[model samples]
Target: MVDTRIPHLPNEILYEIAGYVDDEDILNLRLSAKVFEYITNDRFATTFFGDRAYELSPEGLEALVKITEHSVFAPHIRTVVIGHGGKHSSAKYHDLLDQAFRNLAAHGNAISIGL
Candidate 1:
């Protein structure tokens, strides 16, 4: 039988490494283990959303709003980068953007929205 255990890593080390990983990889890491779940969370908002501001979509915006719904995860988001330029500017996209901002505003954390 093959050993499938992951090496133990400090949270600080994991967080540092996370900065270089893309959103998909970071989200995947969050689901790998309890420790990684903790590690990925420390920078979830910034790493996942901030790094992919240009590629934001309605689905992505919805996901971001869902995370900010949590009190623990909400404060990690200090800056929100919203890209208004999209090839398809549909009503659905606008609705998602509005909802995302409203959700963030409800947190009352004074987040700065970047373009």
Candidate 2:
């Protein structure tokens, strides 16, 4: 049997390998081993959550709230894109937007918001 397990590689080597792969490949690598998950956490968070876009709806705001609450992912978020696609005058929509803005306000790392 060929001993080709990836976990046997040093963490430095694994990180180097991660740096060479694209986002989809990196996600697959994370699924392949726990070591990959541990080593690629920062890169994964930064790559996927650095700039986020969400629709101006309850569902989208909920997702944003969840991401903002995440300790690992929240800090990596630098910009947010809120699409104004739905009805703007609904009270529920305004409420969710208010809540989302509050959450984003608390996320000090977030620098820009696009509408």
Best by lDDT: 2
Instruction: State which candidate has the highest TM-score.
Output: 2
Candidate 1 TM-score over all chains jointly: 0.48
Name the Cα RMSD for model 1: 6.2
lDDT of 1 by residue, 1-115 (tens): 7544544666566667666778768777777677777766656765544333433666667776676677666655677676657555546577677766677678776777676
Q: Native-vs-model 1 lDDT? A: 0.65
List the candidate 1 regions with Cα displacement exceeding 4 Å. 1-56, 84-86, 90-92
The collision pairs in model 2 are none
lDDT of 2: 0.81
Query: In order, what lDDT does every prediction score?
Result: 0.65, 0.81
